[model samples]
Target: MLGPDPRTTLVWALLLDWLGQLLILALIVWIPPALDWSIGGTQLAGQYPWILFCVLLYPLLGWLFGSYTVLHWRRLPMLVLIQRLLLTAAATLAAVAIARWLINPGEEVWLVYRRVQVVWLVSLSGWSLLVRLGLRQGMLLPDTPRLLLLAGDEERDRVLQAWRRVPQRERLRPIQPQQLEAELSRLDVAMVLTLSPKIHRDPALRSVFQHLETADPRWIRVVSPERLFEAMQERLPPALLAEQGLNYDDLPWAVTFSIQAQLKRAADFLVAALLLLLTSPLIALAALLIWWDDRGPIFYVQERSGWLGRPFTVLKLRTMAVQSPGSPATWTQLGDRRITRVGGWLRRVRLDELPQLLNVLNGEMSLIGPRPERPELEEELEQHIPHYRKRHWMRPGLSGWAQVCAPYASSIEDSDLKLSYDLYYLRHFSTWLDLMILFRTIKTVLKAGGR
Candidate 1:
């Protein structure tokens, strides 16, 4: 798989982007009219209708600017994206200006002279930029090449050579077959993009992979150089095939849910509300301890990758000191030094994450689903973890099936396996499954399973 398939992500992103633009436009429409404040008095009174035309123009400009496509490969070069956005805004404004002149021929030319369209253009561009940039940076951390052990050295070299021509090939590490199993055991290998043509002849590799399947189902098992390639390519349609960087497994939600999405939303709201009410006391205590231990703010509100790859601020009790800021959007570990004494206890009891209930209430997360991750981490994982970004289809959660089933994940490989459990949850997300997870989460908390 090239990366995370983002079809569903694209749909939701476009919807939200358009919705946000409409809201801003609506506000502009009502605010000035409500105040009875005309923009230049006479001619501008009902003439403000053109503002709506300008407003509608902005999001269309954004779409053309590639705002919708930024999340496709996890991170597009920021400068390049910005440049495209600016150019698109300019073109869109020009088009709008032409249309305005064509429609309202004889209106006072002085009124049109204000160039107030710049306000809509700049504001819309800025807002869209922030949404895209914040979202991209929030969910996807900087890309670090993952260590990959290709089981077929000859085929691996060929694939590596082919991909190396592309400049963004920093995300994969091709290693020899002899070193594969040990690396897999060490949890160092992000995936085994196996060109296992020799699988028919080599019982050894097959047996090793069988064991690996139990330990890490999320490991990439690519059979390079023949039938497997054709199988994968044939599966997807051509138009969809062009955006081929993402993987099949990336969209767990599409494969998982067969019913209406309303049920999931209702579950999230209800569960998040209930959890907030029930855990208020514990949350307060956790906040006090966090403040006392670190002499800083109680909550750590960092952006996490949410449903459809949108950025949402995830709430957690501050576990780290203010001085030692986290490596920009990295994953937490079992024994990270940034953890304060009280914070450590809070993590053990899973109390630190109580504040995520606020995120759930705000509709930024779900009650039970795949754990929302740092933006940077998600980007890195998508590079090596096949279908990694697919977990973003459903809203991220406070407690998840993967969180319960997997041990504390300290590395990318650990994350990959946890993804299997996450995919399982995405495939089987329902009320009963959520209840099961909730019940199990109670036991896990009592046992101090989190760290």
Candidate 2:
């Protein structure tokens, strides 16, 4: 059992998935033609060739959605892949249905082949599942050694203990701080994972890189111990990277801000538009519900701090009972008396903010940025948190880097750390990075990260 190579495994999985889809498509497309039997009386129509085009799409979708990443196969992640398979199957069904409707629309075909359409969907879903499962299982056979070094002894021991509890401990070897230099020389290790910040700063340990270069370069395996564990990771942005010895303030701020902001806003407009379109029905339904509740305005607009301390009215469906009472801006509590039943659900799933799409469209917000806060909260926060106002340097977002990384911000400390992530997004904005944040936000919304 050879352990799967993370880099090459994705490529191979995609190829294999494509091959399986092609074979299944061929069988569906050709077998019907060969049989000369009308599939539910569609008469083996001219539209059968379109199945090839639809089949080619599934593999790319699967790869993009991470339906094929199984290099770190574990029970929970395997279950996640299975769920992705179900979604992929659903998407496949929708795509095929759309294709048929658009390109294969003949009343005779619809009338004759209604039942066969169901069969085709079932078969395609089954085929996709088989490929996904086969690829997942193929990775379970350990062929290569995955030696993960826990650089910090205390942190490493904790992880080592956890892995040992997993019955498959044979696949992992935890290297303590002292043994790191000696182990790197042996050179056949597939992964050298480090998760200890303490280990990263050690001058003696850093010198091991020189020794490793002297050894077999093919034995190249450098795992960021920092990436190996979540607790060890800092959420700081580049501007406040003084602790990490990085200084964004020293660099060209105007060029950096202009380019990054342009990319971020472009992404914001594209994503916000797509999301508004995709969820239009839901937004409509929510709007109707909100109006029915109080016969008041469905969309609530509140003044919130925006880029560079600019004030903007952030949009939301009125979730609170009072239009204006108590403080002008306050955080909604876990069980607030002001919340309606619908409001509670909205807060839970974060649907209340759907109207923010309008804000995004109006250029007041980005789809992904720092969450806009009340001016009152901003003034208070800036006093305590270092560089807290730095978050306002970019437009506030509907969903943000901090919202995905940290759980719902309730306390000042949580908000402060979240500000760090917001600054990070402003500094490192890109289309690809926005996609990553969107993916992370989905997981956060699903509560899949377990907070």
Using alpha carbons, what is the TM-score of model 1? 0.45
What TM-score number comes out for model 2? 0.65
Off by over 4 Å in 1: 1-260, 324-327
* The best candidate in terms of TM-score: 2
Tell me the deviation in Å of residue 243 in model 2.
2.5
lDDT by residue for model 1 (83-186), tens: 86788678876886687678764545322334445644566667766667655543333222143535455656654453432234235566655776666666
Q: In the order shown, what is each candidate's alpha-carbon RMSD? A: 22.3, 6.7
lDDT scores in order: 0.62, 0.62
- Could you give candidate 2's per-residue lDDT for residues 52-71 as a string of tens digits? 55556676456445576443
